[model samples]
Target: MARVELYVSADVEADGPIPGPYSMLSFGLAVCGTFDGTRFTAPDPSERTFYAELKPISGDFDPQALEVSGLDRERLLREGRDPAEAMRAAAAWVKTVADGALPVLVAYPLAYDWMWLYWYWVRFTSRSPFGHSRHLDIKTFYAARAGAMAARSTKRQMPAALLSARPHTHNALDDAVEQAELFQNLFRWGG
Candidate 1:
């Protein structure tokens, strides 16, 4: 029996910096690759994915953050899905795509995305599919694998081969897919 891990690239668009004080307006997940202890298989970014927009939990939000995402707070207030239902659906989707493999969340800088995701998972679904700590930070992973200083791990500093071809549009799903490509590239990169 070999250990299996599903690399899920997740991106979140939020109203503010923190979860409790603000809210995660939308999120997207794309299964980038899978590793079965020995080898990795990269998937098409559009293959298996999930996206959701949730109603705000709090009235307070940073105007600048909202601007970054280009999501209308007023529209979300009127049309967003319930957080609990959205989280449950997302968790179920993760499980379905993972198909018994351990699902590991992957993000550019896990700090910000993971914060909103983990908090929302617990607050809405009562548990996280990634089990609280199983996450990959792309920037950090690249820094460690490439022997670059942590502070200098920006995409511009990385090799051209490891960067995604897609643009970093603020749309959660688009960014998730873009990051999925990035994750595949980084996973295939050798020391």
Candidate 2:
């Protein structure tokens, strides 16, 4: 078993068409054990997933994504914390609760979380945790490993044998799971 300290997974609900140039709505995190020769199958049980929502600085949000999230604006305003506060709380929890890499699984281009976190941290404290510039793009790695399996589009492809049902995009945790599935597929195909 490869001794991995920890593994963390994060999902961000963005306020814009995507995750930049606007604001964030909510963020959730799931923490697990590192590789352990099982490719991070079993997460540490003590610290489960934590979900947090934030109030937008301006209420002008992307209506389409909003519909997808199904978040109630009024409820967010009532319950949401400021972005800085939320990020700080998130950082605190991650630092204390997680024990893996500096950053967690984003299932996206690093820029997505980088920008959101940069905006919040700099706006409040003038710093971003991602300054070091180390990140792993799962699809990129998978495509490289699965050169012949390339589907010609800039999206991740799961071999039919690996999928449980159908592919549903945009749901954060679901996407993360799908990405993991793709990685596993690549590993299996390689062997």
Candidate 3:
């Protein structure tokens, strides 16, 4: 099989989890280590891009999360694109970059990236844009490697010290970079 380059979808949420019936505040995304991109755009029709962002549906922002993402709510309201635009852009970007089969690796699989994205799409666009139903859950992958595997939830993650990992920006792009680094580290550690 051809080597499958990496792609990630990320989100920097406020306080609410999936079924957010709560809120998602802001989001940013980037694809790295393959296309040599400074932004999320895919350079070729066959290449792929990873995406992320924060979406505040209900207006409830988590103080800590807000502090972490550093996205200005007012700025988002004034400048941010609508959910439809974002999704369409994301799908178009992916069409340009993705070369894999299906079911890509996302940090938290169902909840964080996939579930939240699906929710946003179904709620706002009335359709789902994802090509697959599965995602590689990093937390569980790390845990299984560490013999402590559990279900995936944003609230959970492999202990940072386990991989001597440093802090993550929690910003969408930064977090995606960190997750890729963590996955690579796990691979090197024989996980």
Candidate 4:
């Protein structure tokens, strides 16, 4: 049997730099593409996705970070889904979309997003759908694949052909879709 890798483009909006001390206000995931050891299939960004806004686990949050997401912190506190429930739902969604393939989380500059997601998964669900280390950083992937300096691998430094048409609206789902487009572009770049 061949291995199947389901590339999931994920994004997160957080209230602070780290989890536990803050919270993941929201998160989104889009199944960008899949490779079944021989061939690749790139899906439209609007297809097969998940999004959630979670209640805070802590009282601390950075005002500026919260502002960036443009989400009402007070409203989230009042109405957001419980973290455990949200994480469980998210995990189930991932499993359903993945359809037995290994789902690998992909994100531009993945560290921050990965931190919030992995922490939430462990803290709430006891394990992650992507496990502890199955993540791909688009920035690092581009740096190595395009021969650019890792420190200078921002989207501005990328080729226009590889950029997504979608705007970066700071909404977790929008960004996830945008990054999904970017990931598809990169995945089909040389083949």
> Which regions in candidate 4 have their CA more than 4 angstroms from the true location?
none
- Any runs in candidate 2 off by more than 4 Å, and if so which? 1-6, 18-21, 32-47, 100-104, 129-132, 148-156, 161-191
Model 4 pairs in collision: none
Candidate 4 lDDT, 54-162, residue by residue in tens = 8888899999998899988899999999999999999999999999999999998899999999999999999999999989999988887888888888999888999
Per residue, candidate 3 scores C-alpha lDDT tens digits across 103-185 of 24456443576666667667666755454453566666666677763753233455544442535666665565555555545
C-alpha local distance difference test of each model? 0.93, 0.56, 0.53, 0.92
Candidate number that wins on TM-score, 1 or 2: 1
What TM-score does candidate 3 get on C-alpha atoms?
0.66
* lDDT tens digits, residue span 38-151, model 1: 899998987899999999999999999988999998999999999999999999999999898999999998899999999999998889999989999999999998999999
Candidate 4 local Cα displacement, residue 41, angstroms = 0.6
> Which candidate leads the pack in lDDT?
1
User: How many steric clashes does model 3 contain?
Assistant: 12
10 residues in a row with least lDDT, candidate 3: 38-47
Ranking by TM-score: 1, 4, 2, 3
Per-prediction TM-score, please?
0.98, 0.68, 0.66, 0.97
Kindly report which residue stretches of model 1 are placed more than 4 angstroms away from their true locations once superposed: none
